[model samples]
Target: MKRFIGFIKKEFYHIFRDKRSLFILFGMPIVQVMLFGFAITNEINNVDIAILDHSKDANTKQIIDKISASKYFSIKDFLDNERDIETAFKKGEIKAVLNFEKDFSKKLMTENQATVQILTDATDPNTANTISNYTSSILSSYQELLNKDISIPYQIGVQTRMFYNPELKSVFMFVPGVMTIILMLVSAMMTSISITREKELGTMEILLVSPLKPFQVIVGKVVPYILLSVINAIVIILLSIFVFSMPVEGNLFLLGAETILFIMNALSLGILISTVSASQQTAMMVSLMGLMLPVILLSGFIFPISSMPFPLQVISNIIPARWFIIILKGIMLKGVGLVYLWKETLILVGMTLFFIALSVKKYKIRLE
Candidate 1:
């Protein structure tokens, strides 16, 4: 027990003595939370739009007034002709063009129906879809106001319920994804580099030649990283809960267990990397280029896997972070238990075993 305590103390000394590691241990979670919460968001406001109101009547004017009053869009240009719409869009002056049919008021009163065409640049499909929805909602509200003055025989309304995110805030999705990425970066990349550093410095040989076994040396090197990763996870969860107002609806114990499982998987990957790499630089480069990039790009962190190219989509299936993120969202946002997330949890366990086996094989080959 005393020896273990001494070992833990030594680990703390090593962590505190290295300024870079110390900074990374404490700084990364805060920076990641701020970046994901404020910067990366799907909710857009003040998008510029162009109006081409051909009707120039009371109905068109009223609709335009309503649109302008809303905060979602800012009317930047008023097009005189159809050609102006194309020119303005080409010049990137506006994201959408609102076109009102000629004699809109006359048609609505006499024909009891009129059509308004909303033309949006589909270059960014998500933004385009959001703008269309906002415009439609404004139109619907205006139609509802008009309907209140008259009596209708039958009325049908569709009710919508957003399951996980009632407010549809993008941060709800981003929080868990960002947390997973930070854990991967810190636990896997840092451990790999630190272990390889001892090998590069000839200290690993000294430890191996001493009374300590190969497994003990590796365990000693990784123990600090595991503890640090747990702290980092706690920090990230706290930030998501308090700072971002994100909910953790599942059992806290389950969340902690899954986090530890992912950390173990990441640490095993680090051990595998350390076995393969001879120098700290090689380990860092491999961790960043080989693991980090795939985890970020292919793990459905920012881009949806369903939307990726066929080959990339297939490749994404193997990224551990992808499954972990799905598990996290299920537990954190949807309030699901282990029954729903067992498949993902099992995949992470399988990956950890694979990494451990590979590292052991490689380490044995090195000894031979």
Candidate 2:
């Protein structure tokens, strides 16, 4: 019994001594709990919306006040004309716009009825549906309050029009997100393991002693993976178009160019991973486990970033997938060109360059 107890004590000491093991034991659970608890909510919080109140009546003012008071929404801006709604949506500033019909109070007094139009961007159908439902509930409550003191029942009709995706198809949202995830994980995983495999086989030394420069070595290692990842992207886009019957509303040539840039970004990230890791297993684990959650959650793939906490929203900005998904939706659904998407495109370009330069620096450090 004493011998067995000593052995157990020694194993515990060994586990406590290893930093990686300690992180796996304690850090992983805390991170997973925090992320899952915070990032997985279905309810919308502080969703940005616009107001276009043509009525400017007492009733319309009261409804606007009620909506602004709700925790689920934030009034981003007030549109002065009908033409500004599209501009708001294309700029990605607001999710929905509330248009109060003219003579709202007059209609309510004479006819006991009025209409409000809810124009929502349905690129993300779940959020659009949620916003519409929540807005309608608030309107219903106001209607009930008005009826409580009067003999006549009042009705506020809500007419919802989903923009970008009129049908609110789930596939339209998923395709861009899935394509980003697959290209990112696959490219990173494959390239990450490649150099690590070489290191484990003892061929990394031979390549290091060869005439190739550090950047050249890194580029040569990643070029093939970039090509493969691009091919994978092409296949996915084709499937999204043909199999899912998804519409490509923007320029196909531009889409192709952006896809290549994203693939290169993913590949460079993989090279960075392999350069830092000592083994294939380590590289593989870092590529898959370290990246999976952030890509899915923080990239605005499943949930709205604006709905998350302010910190998470800020952290999401650094994620390449977030920018790429924006580009995809802009081109595929909104039909916006580079003129409008320049910021997101520039972001991807900067990230790709940063990853490649950092990987080269890490590679040169290793050569020392």
Candidate 3:
């Protein structure tokens, strides 16, 4: 027990002595939270739009005023010709173009309806769709105001219920993803680098020459990381719950268990990387380039798997973080239990086993 305490003390010393590790350990969580919370968001606001109003009429003017007044869009430019629309878009000044047809008010009075062409830059499909929706909503509201005295024969109303996020807060979506990324960074990247550091410093050889078995040394190194990762996970969860007011619908015990499992899986991957990499830099690069990229891109954190290219979709199936993220969303947001997340749990377990097996094999080769 005294020896174990001494080992843990040494581990803490190593952690605190290294400024880079300390910065990553403490600063990364806050940075990730801030980046996800403020920088990366799906919600659209203050979109710049250009209007080409050939029709100098009250109705056209009214529509333009309504659009400009609404919070979603800001009129960036008033163009005279269609050619300027393309030029403005090329210059990246406007996201959308609202073209009012000639004699818009006269046509509306004579024909009861008028044509207004909305030409949008579809390069960013999401922004384009949002701009279109906002424009349509503003026009509809204006029409409703104009027809306040008249009553329609039939009216259809859409009651939209955003199931998981009623407020559509980006924090709810990002908390899980940020947690996953931090866990991956701490457990996988840090462990891999730390383990390889021992090898590079020639301490691993002395440890191997001592009474400590290869497995024991590896376990001792990893156990502390696992504990630190669990603590970090708790810190992040508490921040999300108290600060962000995020809900944890499922059992907290189960969430903790699954988080430990993910950390173990990540730690196993780190061990495998350390076994293959001779230097800490190589391990860090491999963990970031190989593991982090996939976890962020293909894990359905930032992009939907269903919308990805078929090959990339298939490739995403093998990424352990993908399964972990699904389980997280299910338990945290959807309020699902072991029954729904069992398949993902099994996949994570399988991955952990595979990583362990590969590491053990490589370790034996080095020994022989």
Candidate 4:
């Protein structure tokens, strides 16, 4: 019993002595708990939506006030024409649009019922579905409130129109996310590991001493992975279009250009990771474990960003995958082009340049 106790104590000491292992043991759990707790949530909040009030009366205003007052949605703009709903959705300004029938108050008072059209941008099926459900709930609550006062037989007929993904196919949502994850895993993780492998094998020093510039060496190492990532992206797109019958509404050339830009961004991130990690094992762990979760969770791939707490939503702004997913949804689902997606494209470009610059500085410091 004494020998066993001593052996256990020694193992504990060994574990405590290893900082990396200790961090992985204790710190990783805390980090993961915080991420899953804070970042991963199903509760929708502050969803950007628009309103088309054909009947701008007391009842319609009351419904609008109730919707705006709810934590689930934020009214962005009061649209004029029914025609503007599609334009607003394409511009990525709103997730859902609420349209009230003309003479809403009169019908509710005399006919005892009124119609409310809930049009959602269903590129993100989960969010769209949630928004529809929440809108219905709110309208139901409003009806209850009205009944409490006068026991009116008024009904709110909700006509939900899920645009882009009318059938709410899960494949429509997953393909873009799968492409983002695969490209990230392949381009960033593989490039980092490949670069660190050269360093681990002592070949990096030889490359440094060679006539090839460090940037040239880094570019040469990453070019293969870039090509692979591009090929993988093309395959994912083809599969989405052919297998899933997913529509590509936007310009194909623009999508290809954006894919190349994102690949370059991910490659820069990999190069930065390689500069920080001394060995291939470290690079692999950092890329696979560190980068993977954020790409999956915080990027709004699985969880709706609006549904997450404010802090997580703010943090998600830094994730490259988040922007890419938005771009993908915009182009693939909304048929939006550069005019609608230029902001996200510029963000990716900025991030790529920042990573490349940081990596270059780190590489120069290592040489010194």
Q: Which candidate comes out best when scored by TM-score? A: 1
True-structure lDDT of candidate 4: 0.81
Reference-based lDDT, residue 135, model 4:
97
Worst 10 residues of 4 by lDDT: 29-38
After superposing candidate 4, which stretches have Cα over 4 Å from the reference? 1-154, 364-368
Ranking by TM-score: 1, 3, 2, 4
Q: Can you write out model 2's per-residue Cα lDDT over 277-325, one digit (the tens) per residue?
A: 9898999899888777899999998889999999999999998999999
lDDT, each prediction: 0.87, 0.82, 0.86, 0.81
- Candidate 2: misplaced stretches above 4 Å? 1-157, 364-368
lDDT of 3 by residue, 1-368 (tens): 55556666777778879999978877888778768877787777788999999997899888998888877789999999988989999999889999999989888888878889898999999878878887887888888887888887798866779998797787888889989999988899888988889888987777667765566666766888888889889988888888888899999999999999999999999999989888999999999998989999999998989999999999999988898899888889988999999999999999999998787777732433
Q: How much does candidate 4 score in TM-score?
A: 0.60
Tens digits of per-residue lDDT for model 1 on 1-368?
A: 45455656776787899999888878987898899898878887899999999989998999999999998899998999898988998999799999998889999999999989999999999999999999998999999999997888787777889998998989998988888888988888888887787788876776556665455655666788888899999999998899889999999899999999999899889988888888889998888888889988999988999999999999998999999999889889989999999989999999988987787667632332
TM-scores, all candidates, are 0.88, 0.60, 0.85, 0.60
- Listing every candidate in turn, what is its Cα RMSD in Å to the true structure after a full C-alpha superposition? 2.8, 16.0, 3.1, 16.5
lDDT of 4 by residue, 217-292 (tens): 6666666556656766776687678766889999999999998999899889999999999988999899998778
Number of backbone-clashing residue pairs for each candidate, in the order shown: 0, 0, 0, 0
Which pairs, if any, clash in model 3?
A: none
**Candidate 3 Cα misplacement greater than 4 A, ranges:** 1-3, 56-58, 80-87, 121-126, 140-159, 167-170, 238-245, 309-311, 357-361, 364-368
Error of 1 at 201 (Å): 1.3
